[model samples]
Target: MDPFKQMGDWKKNMDQFFGDNFWDEFEGIIKPNIPQINLYQTEHELFCVLNIPGLHDLEKIDIYADMATLELRGVIDLEFGGGQVIKEEILQGAFERQISLPFPVRSDKITATYRNGLVYIRLHRLISETSNKRRVNVRLLEDE
Candidate 1:
């Protein structure tokens, strides 16, 4: 029996069983449902854009910002109006997740805005390490 031929047959069988969307299904299982976000950094601030459609009642959303972390707690609900769900793709229900910022920010100076079904959060940088630089003098010890 040829080992290469057996391996080829096994590969064909596995491909047929998993089909095209196998990887997509696997990714969904691993990550579950979480709101997608886009983060951008600039010299003065860090911006985060969160995709949250069909989410009514802005008051239900809670966002907490810190120098190193950003916390979000929110609920998303969509009305289908008395019908069995044949297919549902959007994430719905309550979600609580903390996002870590790449650079330290001034929590007190952070600002946020909501427009066109998107939440934009701006975290002002807190003396980013790139800007605040100081040189220390090195002292040599005398030999005994």
Candidate 2:
């Protein structure tokens, strides 16, 4: 006699036949979490190149490093007004990516330079050996 009651009854039957956990597991896989990263390691140091364009200010970039981990945070603006976006593929928003370093580096000595569209960062490897006291005898001057 009631339209609302009929729809509710149909939903219950459909869910029971399909199993109650159907939608539960379906939603989890449908929308999943993904981490963004691109990293490589060489014998000397580890290199990480992140694709960041339209970042104007140097203060926008934040880089921090510890003994093993390095953190990078920045924002990529997607504000291009007055034009309709027909197709959008690139990510544009606040992004924070953390990468693990292959070897430890001095945080104070780390240098970063941005050019073109990529951010280049150089991390110096920690020095294990330094010049110490070692005396070598040299022969007196001989004129030829």
Candidate 3:
């Protein structure tokens, strides 16, 4: 029995069972019935884009990140209803999406903005650390 050949066959079997959308399936188990998000990465930084339409205010969007995880939460309003009900394909109501980042991100230097119908956020990969020092003098008081 060849060990390398056996391992290769096992890998193919697992991939076939999971399919190409294994990540999507894994995310669904954790967060059921939530809006999907697309994440991209580069050598310098990470790019995240979410599909949220009918957003009235940009302030409504909230983004938070730690050393290893980046979380996104927001609400989207879908106005539907006229006189007749024919077909509905778009997802309505509020949605919240949370994604795990590959590397550590600088939370303070994070920038985000919402334009048109999509929310864009730019996260810096290599964060420069800054340090500041301050000195204070204290005087002793005498009691009479």
Q: Candidate 1 has what TM-score?
A: 0.65
Please state the error at residue 113 of candidate 2 in Å: 0.8
User: Per-residue lDDT of 1-144 in model 3, one digit per residue for the tens?
Assistant: 866567557767877998756645655553354444677899868888777888887777777887657776777666655676444445555666567888888777777777878778888785556656556789899998
The TM-score measured for candidate 3 stands at: 0.59
| C-alpha lDDT (0 to 100) for residue 107 of candidate 3 | 79
Off by over 4 Å in 1: 1-29, 128-144
TM of each candidate vs. truth: 0.65, 0.58, 0.59
lDDT for each residue of candidate 2 in 1-144, tens digit (9 for 90 to 100): 866567657768978899777656554253221123466766767666667777788798888888768888888774687777555456576766667787887777777777765777777776667777789999999898
Give the lowest summed-lDDT range of ten residues in model 2: 27-36
Which digits, one per residue and each the tens of the lDDT, describe model 1 over residues 1-144?
A: 866567657756876998756655555464464667899998888889988777667887888987789899988777667877545567677778788888778877977778877899988878744755678899999999
Per-residue error (Å), model 3, residue 101: 0.8
What are the clashing pairs of model 3?
none
Off by over 4 Å in 3: 1-34, 126-144
Clashes of each: 0, 0, 0
Best by lDDT: 1
